[model samples]
Target chain A: MTRVRMDLFVSLDGYTTSDPTPDDPMGPDWGRLTAAYTATRTFRERIFGDTSGAGTTGVDDTYAAAFFEGIGSEIMGAGMFGLHTFPDDPDWKGWWGDRPPFGTPVYVLTRTAPRPSISMDGGTTFHFRNAAIGDVLAEATDAAGGQDVRVGGGIGTALEFLRADLVDDLHLMVAPIVLGRGLRLWDGVPALDRSHTVTTEVAESGTIHVTFTREQHA
Target chain B: MTRVRMDLFVSLDGYTTSDPTPDDPMGPDWGRLTAAYTATRTFRERIFGDTSGAGTTGVDDTYAAAFFEGIGSEIMGAGMFGLHTFPDDPDWKGWWGDRPPFGTPVYVLTRTAPRPSISMDGGTTFHFRNAAIGDVLAEATDAAGGQDVRVGGGIGTALEFLRADLVDDLHLMVAPIVLGRGLRLWDGVPALDRSHTVTTEVAESGTIHVTFTREQHA
Candidate 1:
């Protein structure tokens, strides 16, 4: 029983990301949006390789740890894969450095011509695909080997799967901020609680974790 | 200290209200947005006058109880008072019954000509005023007699006070649902945590209770 999972960080007002600059490609508000998640011990261990364990340990850390678990394959947009940032850089890999946090086969959905797969130092491999969402998901599912196929989003790609009803679990980390700009994640989606079992928890740092698990899948 | 407090119910997607009709003046999504708050024990006791104690008592009920406490006077928009629904009906006295919940001076902000104040059965008086937000707030404060002056909102009227930096405490009941439409309350407001002590707690009904208390006021 393979499940499609997605994790998104957004402001309380529903803004995902804001204006991007040369230094911060993800956007200026992206840091504020992801402050709680990044302030977790698990994030320091998995993302920054801080083995000293010098970060907040609570619900936020638990979610951060769960984010990297049970994900056997990944599906992300070209933006998440740094294609939008470094479009012409043939030598460019991704923002995740030589060894990305994902230790699985990652399918980067792009509209450009297909490029050869790139295997990193870790157990992660990036496969560029110029195909439809369903086709790409099928490939990602096959690569998952019955595990969860995680959607590594930049919001646009995640929304495509969500609007198409392909996601089984949608977890949103809402920071206590009023980001006046950027796109809302749940713009055209149906009320989640109607079809899914919605659960919410507040982290010690004031980040609200809301998860909508599909009732059928649950 | 006479703090200017406000309580708002909105979807997790930030929509305060959706397409309204003659039947549901607040909107179709109003019920969905306010389900958790309305289901609280305090709401059942205060709003509906249900003395049987037949409602959930949790973090939501605590907040619902606080909503009516210390609010000596309130200022609300004309829409919230059902002015838009019944323009010509001189006898229109709002959705709340003869004994309205707030036993205080309720100032109805409207552009129409001021009418004689309607004093309800249970200490509730509707004073129609067509003045600036500050002026009405000042009048409401004076009527409060050193107690807290609450901004009873329908989004439009609430934003006026919020934008004008008149509110010292803002509490939002964020239901775990996507409305997808209507107006966002914090569209242009700065990040709350920057100037206020923002706290979040999850109610048993999955409704996230976020309170932004002004640090200066605190």
Candidate 2:
């Protein structure tokens, strides 16, 4: 069975953005945080079809590359797929340009009607899954071969997996800053049972990297 | 005249929260980020009615205190006032407790029908404003005295003020992470010929602080 992992950076308060869309000022951090990936040979070759980023490195870049290299497929929430206003527009793909960073199949969870798969470069394909969480996970697993399946989170999608206890591992790079107000993680969910054990901790460049793995309950 | 300053911690890709509401794992970062405000004696006494805090006695306390002590009034967007599902609910107060952290008056920008003022202890009051941005800013300035009125941003509200060129200063603390998705700060706004001059840079244990004062355009 492929373990489900979720990896993302979260504020000290746990908001994904300042609003319901991906075009906010906070959006630029993605490029900055992922700058290391662009400086990697694997990242450039796999996603951008370029050989420019060979041998260049940083600790952040290495960590990110390792994480991305392990992922076989990605499942994202509908809000993560499109801006909140353009949720229903089939024409609008995503904020990422023609070739997205993810070089694997991307499953978008939405309540909208199903549509045909949109194929991009580097073997990446966007599959809209209107089915339940279980169905989506199963399809993504099948599409992922035997590798790990990552939940490309947007709070809503990650909560569904967390609520279902379908998530196996979690990696959060906590940035020490607060929005004071915005969308929040764990806003409407029930209190969680503390069974997960911290498996790793790495403090790097003003961010804390923490990993938690679910413990097997007898 | 009082200047309105919007302060927020956003992801690289831009998102206010991990989810629309607060129940997601990514939402916890917001709590940690806002916890910085509790570090100040004045802010702590005003918000929580106490001076003692858990592990808030060092340099962290000073930095946190400085961030919150400078703000005056707060402004937020309608979607940020509550969950999107409760758009029609007149009874939905914000996620904050009865007495919010802001000791000053708060403005909730919305097209919805304005409600009566919600007064709370510690001098925090909720006043719904449905007027134009200019009128709202003017009212907020009067309420703020000579202090900088802080726009309690939800991306949309911040972008609106940024579009109108009403914001005098912006304190954007970029977290070292990427949501890779979620609400963006400048999603639908028209481009502006604005330039930012970095006033201060502080690399702390958890995140870097970069303050930018909007430079006067030629």
Candidate 3:
């Protein structure tokens, strides 16, 4: 079964990322908001491309390593892919640069004109799609080759899949920082316990990891 | 030091409570949202008047027991005192019955006409005040007889104190439910790390106890 998974680093107040400003293309708040996750060994190796293994190998790294374990195909919003920051700049190859971290078939959800898919140095191939969550998930599943389909986010994209009940597992790392204002992730998400088995783990890094596994109902 | 303290039972998504309706005065959400808190021995005894020691005495109960410790008064919003549920009826003495809970001076922040103070069977005295958070906290601190001043909440009331940087110690229990909507407690509060030291402890009852102690600034 190709389960839909999501892993988001959110502020204590539910903000996943701050608005992108010219001074800070990735948003000045993203660093502080995602400090714990970015400090993990897996993040430094997989996401940051640091082969020196200089990151923490504690509880946080364990979860970070598990995040990319079974993921075969990735579906992300245009915002997460940096299109929201550089909508007019056609030269932007995403914030991840030439060799994107996601070594899988990536689906970028957008309503812009259909363009050719961009293949990165890694196995990552960015495919453009303009469809509802279900349709895109179906396409992502087919591209996943029976592996898990991961929903990469910028909050808005993740909520769309969650609200549609398409996500099977959600792992949210609650950082201690509180972004007073930004895009809230849990705004329209209904009481998850009604349909999911929710559990929590507190890491020594002051990050509370919350996982919501959707329950199979009769 | 008489630190201003707060202990709120909030959902995983940050909702403190739901709106009261005709059929369900406290709304259907409050019961499930407050299950962990209400099931504690301290809650069963203090809030429910259960003296049989029937409730669980776990990590949640330990925090529940500490919630009332200190020498002081309490500041609460009108909604928390049940005035919102029975706005037209002036006879409602709150949901705590005749004796009430707190054995100290209780200041209810309300915009209604100044009514005579109600001295419950217990030492609790309900004093209605139509003033800002600073003024009320000052009065509550003075009335507390040099002890701690607790800001009892239904979320909005607590946010008022937190936003003003008046609360010294905040202890929030994150319940397992995701109330899709309600009064969010962390809405306008900026990154707490800027002013407070945050720590988390997960209980056997699945409630994550988060504490934020105000840092002393020069």
Top candidate, metric TM-score? 1
iRMSD, all candidates: 1.9, 10.8, 1.2
lDDT tens digits by residue: candidate 3, B55-90: 989898899889878848998988888887788887
Candidates in order, TM-scores: namely 0.94, 0.46, 0.91
Residue A61 CA error for candidate 2 (Å)? 2.6
Best by DockQ: 3
lDDT of 3 by residue, A1-218 (tens): 78899988788878777776544544678888788888888988887679997998998999998987988899998887877777887767788788888889999999887667899998889998988888989999999998999998767788888887788888999987777877788877866787889989888788889999976621
Error of 3 at A68 (Å): 1.2
Q: Which TM-score value belongs to model 1?
A: 0.94
- Kindly report the docking quality category of candidate 1: medium
Model 1: per-residue Cα lDDT over B39-146, one tens digit each = 988888887779999999998888988887888899998988988888888989998888888889999999997789999988999999999888888889899998
lDDT of 2 by residue, A70-154 (tens): 6889999877877464755768777677878777899999887887888886667898888999999999989889888999767
**Candidate 1 clashing pairs, residues 3+ apart or interchain:** none
The true-versus-predicted C-alpha distance at residue B217 of model 2, in Å, is: 31
